[model samples]
Target: MWKKKTKQFMSAGSETKQTLHENLAFTAVEQYKLIRANLDFTLPADEKCPVIGITSAMRGEGKSTTAVNLSYVFAEKGSRVLLIDGDLRRPSIAKKLDIDNTHGLTDLLRGKGARIEDFQSKRRDNWYVLPSGAIPPNPSELLGSDRMANVLRQLREMFDYIIIDLPPLNLVSDAISVSPLISGMIVVIREDHTEKKELEKCLRQLQMANVRVLGCVMNGVKTGSASKYARYKYYGNSSRGTGK
Candidate 1:
């Protein structure tokens, strides 16, 4: 099991990157690498351009951080990865990654007359980000719209992996709306924060929706929190099946 990563809740912009670099424990990095390996093993081999969604049962469970770091790890091998700010209601990727949100996923989903690439800003070599754009009046409607499908279709041809940072499942259905679009979803659960009931309910929701849930990632773990240490060790050994 990984130890509690200090300051896991990162600051905005460049500070986010700095905090991540400063605070990410060796165990945490290895855990994420293992997560990538597990996903690579579990995801259908035929799906070349996998679209993975990152979400949580409730807010502030480090879903965005997971998405960003996962994207970072995915791109480490020169794989083209695009991290999209799918949480249109309360966008975070732009602030977290310090990218522009002037026009992005929301814009493309609203039928904006422009190429999808026009809205995306490259964050690094082979890494790009499509921000949430202006906050939409009806995020669910836009996410479930035909334009969203079109945008994804276009994105598939461009990137090896598309990581979408979605809103909390318990808070809204925005995550559910995009469920059909993703190859699979990973639920982020924070230690000492996410309740067992909430996790059960989240699994029920995913089961009911028939979302191809990959599994849950345990976040904010404490090094010496006894059962939490044991629980995270369990997660490390059997990550993809632990939550369910």
Candidate 2:
């Protein structure tokens, strides 16, 4: 499922290093707000926390950064949010957030039988983080396993929103494997970095997996004066009926 009437929101000069910082681009705050509002349409009508998986057609498109900042926006709005670094292959949230990656998704998937709270590191008052524990030999298999499904089930019950940072769809099976388990997907695309054919192939992969694409986030839009920072844009149908 996709739609034609796409809604778009953009920002200029948003740095990839720490868009979470207060001194970020002038349009940074507004950008996050619009992006959050865009995702609001995908929330369940009955209050079940929406699990939004963020991924890209290829790497370095800023998907992980988007996921982290999106979670921060939700948390800032008083929502209890959990940001999971689901990109086990090349995890980055731990480093980005400066949170411990000691124990996380992989540990739980391996039947650690631990409390969700124990593995998660609370970065902010409302934002809890679950870094990709340890790189495993079989990322795709671990992500698609029944244990992973159960982990997400538990996550849904424990937070207002769970934002999973998945790997690029075209480069790895990790994103596609876990796409079925999420409420919806947000595709991140860099202005000139991502290839057109790759984006098409990624969309087809999502289509074949039967995952609802909540929207597409366009990153690194060049602005004359605003080029000092990195910014993002989300294109989707904001008027679409809520949830998948």
Candidate 3:
């Protein structure tokens, strides 16, 4: 049943990547549902509106895609999900979602008396997006500021799930600075692009910061077919999977 649903959701190649649109394939939806389930199982039961950070070992590993899709699936399941473009260094949620990027995280954290509602943009009935706003010169400092924490706290009261798309772990320290505030972090790795050594170093950095490693999403797994259903596999903390 699940397989059939997934096949219905996903059609072929690039089309399967349209998880943000209304015509998202069932395959993409199913994959995100699997990720959401894994996240639910990984987080503490007491944590509410849990802020989950989606990151990768390096750039182009599909962290933003994972974050957006995960938030879409959660909102589809009736949970109010807020997708935050925490990757201030290179924001893409606005462009990918085709929404307004006039204001967002940086604006809210700038301490200019900006409110959360002022920067937030709704993508769906229950799904919202907060773009990275204007790229700041000091992304690390802004992300680590007390204002950022306050923004998150305020968001938790209004959202059931706050999915943050952060910069790659190996590229910068921005993710590490924001790690302590999130409930857990999901590492996305491309099967062909991410090297084993790089993935190890990424995990080590997260470990040193005491970031809760929820699990990993193995992305870009080729099945020797031109199918649009990209293979995605999840592994929990106790049984982390090895990257290519």
The lDDT of model 2 is 0.77
| CA deviation > 4 Å runs, candidate 3 | 1-24, 113-115, 118-123, 224-226, 238-244
Candidate 1 weakest lDDT stretch, 10 residues: 1-10
lDDT of 3 by residue, 114-233 (tens): 465543343456777778878999988888888889889988999999999999999999999988788889999988899999999999999989998888988777755444554666
Models 1 onward score TM values of 0.83, 0.86, 0.85
Clashing pairs in 2: 7-236, 13-229, 13-230, 14-229, 14-230, 14-231, 15-230
* CA lDDT, candidate 1, residue 219: 74
Order the candidates by TM-score, highest first: 2, 3, 1
Number of backbone clashes in candidate 2: 7
Task: Please give, for residues 72-191, the per-residue lDDT of candidate 1 as tens digits.
Answer: 778766888888989988888777755456777776776776455453333345767677888988988778777788889888999999999999998899889988888888888988
Error in Å for residue 115 of model 2: 3.1
Report the C-alpha lDDT of model 2 over 1-244, residue by residue, as the tens digit: 0011111112212333445544457576667777898788655567589888999898898888788778878888999899899999999876666555677788888877656656343345567778798899999998888989998898888899999999999989998898778888999999889999999999999999998888888877776655455476668744365322
